[model samples]
Target: MYQLSEVESNYRRLFKDFLRNSYISGLKPLLLHSPVQYAKALWLAFLAVIVVWTHIVVVNLTLEYIDQPTEIHMAPNLVHVSNSPFPAVSVCRSNMINRGLMNNYAFKIYQHQTQYEGTFANDSRYPPLDLERLTDRLMLLTNFFLNTDGKHLDIDELGQLHNLLTSYYNGSVYSVHDILRELTPDCGDLVVRGIIYGMPVNTSQLFLKRATSSGTCCIFNYRRPSYSQSPGQRELDDAEMAALPQVVFESNSILNGIQFVLQDTHQDDYTLSFLTNTAFRLQIFPQEDYATVQSNKHGEILVDHNTIVEVPIQPKFFDSSAAVRGVTPKVRRCYFPEEGRKLLNQSYYSLDECILLCRINSMLQHCGCASSPMAGTALNVSYCTLLDLPCLMKWRGIWNGFNEYPYVEQYEEGAEDASSMSQCPLCLPNCDGVNFEITSNVAPLRKAFNATGYAHGLLKSLNNDRPLSIIKLFFKLRFAQSTQMAMVGDWVVLLNRFGGILSLMYGFSIISYIEIFYYLTGKWFVLYYRECHKQKNDSNKTELDSSSLHWNE
Candidate 1:
């Protein structure tokens, strides 16, 4: 420490000597002796400040200028999936009554259930109604009344039984007889699937919950539908047909708000056939060092990857964040590649693939499984079970940029699930690379009933006594597809090296102002401090001499 302080002291002395010499030999001796020279020096200093100010303004303006020229051209027609950076499908549940019931049930169980009841419910997460399992004695008693009884129960008898069973439910019991008689099934042969491709928000799990009677048993039947495609074979009445659930994609909706509803029907044998096709086109720069450009005889330079492209200045929006937060710009601005980070990656993936990969990897990490809607026989990934849903939802909430507490408990680092979805190098998306424009047309599919077709044979073989119902829903989402070689990209080039260096005369550069500021202001304070110290010492000496003469007299 002592040596370091000594070195610093030596450097300070050297700097002081240099400053003193410059003032004494150069400007001070010349300017102080001559008022004309001093005025000239003052005038030059004032002018230098103005020049520096002008340079600062020029730099700010130049930063906003379009230095590079960009050529916009539509490449060959491409075919791809609809899951561009974001393809959201919002599904409104047609079954409002069932939805209300389920919402109430979920809330009641979650809110009022004891720890033991919660554990029991978790253990009895079975299909249809994920309720707590009854003990053997209770099960046997239910079986004796429901299935083992020799006599078929009348409506009155069933109502009485329901009352007995739900005595502890505080008058919230649903009548089995009334539900059976009143509930109308949806249209037969209407299979549906709504798959969200680009964003990580699970459209499957988001079911619309309408507020109804808080404690009524009517809320007991609602089950949140997962995004899925199922065969719809149950025949529906006129009201059910009109109220058929439909998947919607509104232009104003965001990715996280996407939703999907699965139809609920009674017939276990009913079958639904749903078909979906998606594609996307991406415009990007070719990664190769050299690209071929065609030009006409008119000296028109055909632009390609290496060609300089001029784009307007604008901030890029991610996840519709600016719009959601009400921070969107009034005037739209375009950003150039040179001005910001490289948004696109030099990889073999199409834009859709890159975005989908991001979604898939996120699901794997947070949800403990891949998206069931995206995963299939071709994709060797497990579907997220009902147990893993809360965990997935919490993770997605965090990723969606919502500044709220996580709904699920935190997972321990290096846990089995955490390690399962480790850093995926391949799942990264080019955040600012390219934007996508998409359009889709959905139509109901009609099929002629063929009794002698293969459908008859399959149904006959599966169950001859009961006729099978078939519901087929067809919709195709066609995205603009481009080959690996043919990409939807434009050329980006840097235009002015120094914002027209030659246009400004006298070889004046912005760097000169920066250098002047550093030299003048950076060390000027220290020099001032030393000068003030010298003046104080001279005054103290003069005071002491005056005091000594006065005392002698």
Candidate 2:
């Protein structure tokens, strides 16, 4: 007889009891011991099958998980107002003295008071640089006299004037007569060569200057689309609504050619300030035609979208090769790829962001006046004049590799200068998932100066003695779209559905679940524990007998 340790005895008893009650001892008999018990047990098995079958067949229902919650972010907005929002104010306070040449072939404009105008607002009193004033300033600075003796001037005389003007004005100033003669071969015989003689009009050509500071002080107002129909909302006719500003997109994705015309300008020294809302509103598909853009109780726009997503701020350049994930789609669209250009340290950017920056750089290099949308750059931003536009278009065409010149077919492919070609490749947007339409307008804010209390105060503070003749444009933007969000099938709903399936499959109810749990946890465990206890007692008695026999032997 072998003497058994207490631990070994306990394990032996446990195994013996498990064998007695387990399936080996006739599982079907134990499960079908009574009619009522068998019925309950059978119903449970059927319910489980129903749970699995319904889960697969139910195509209308789906389980979705919201990976990212929706949130509102306040970030700096970068906007482009084409056609130079900030024009240069070249005020020429000149009562000029003109000297006429023989047959009035050329004239000298001299003695003009010249100074810069307000960068934000062009004061009506301090007008911009007109043709006459510019000509006068050039003549006075270079000390060049009129060369009107003949249509064609002596080479020596022309060279002297050109050299003097170029040296004095840093080559920025050029005589209109010389330019006309060079452009037109037969201009020598023509009486009119674009320059007005004798009494000259002191007109102003405004140039947009770079911002001295970062903050743009302008008020913004938001309004629903004219087609919007809500309670207390009145639909406006086309005549009453302000027309959207014309945005010209001929060659590039960048909305770089926007023209804001100042209608009914009664004064020359009017100041214009650009206006836009502090935050951009994005509205996805809704029953209403337009987004409900009213300020909530918390002063935030009430936003409702199918799926809420988070987006990063713009103007941050990025490299294309980075493996960063979880970027929102809206943020991704802001990046534009530049093939030949690379930032010093950054490696990623949104599509539109990169293109806009490239557009600004391009305009700065070619037009000599950078768009005012960009700030804190090394180059000073200024407005491009109508005269400077032709040069801009030519340079832009050369860089973009798409010449818009009427006679571009005549030029040989490799004959054009390679240095002027665009080093960056063109970036196109993916239109598959993205589609948006915007309606906006830029209107004069002078009427608001009297209507609104804030504007009245501002008017009094800024222009107390002077009349409120500053030119200000109010910009309004409305955006709408459709977005998808991750969804999860509700657990409660699934449980109810499972219960319904079980009821249809068998006459089962909530009590069936209770019965199954009780049988598995309470009844089955109690029976097994008692059986193990009896086996343990018997094993212990046998072990004691074995120990006694061993001792006796």
Top model number, TM-score: 1
Q: Write the per-residue lDDT of candidate 2 for residues 203-227, one digit (tens) a residue.
A: 1111111111111111111111222
User: Distance from true position, residue 399, model 1, in Å?
Assistant: 2.4
lDDT string, candidate 1, 22-82, tens digits: 4122323322345464675775576566557656755654554333122223435643333
**To one decimal, what is the Cα RMSD in angstroms of model 1 from the true structure?**
20.5
- Please provide TM-scores, in order, for all candidate models, with all chains considered together: 0.28, 0.23
Clashes of 2: 31
Model 2 TM-score is 0.23
Can you give the lDDT of residue 191 in candidate 2? 9
Q: After superposition, how far is residue 92 of candidate 1 from its true place, in Å?
A: 6.9
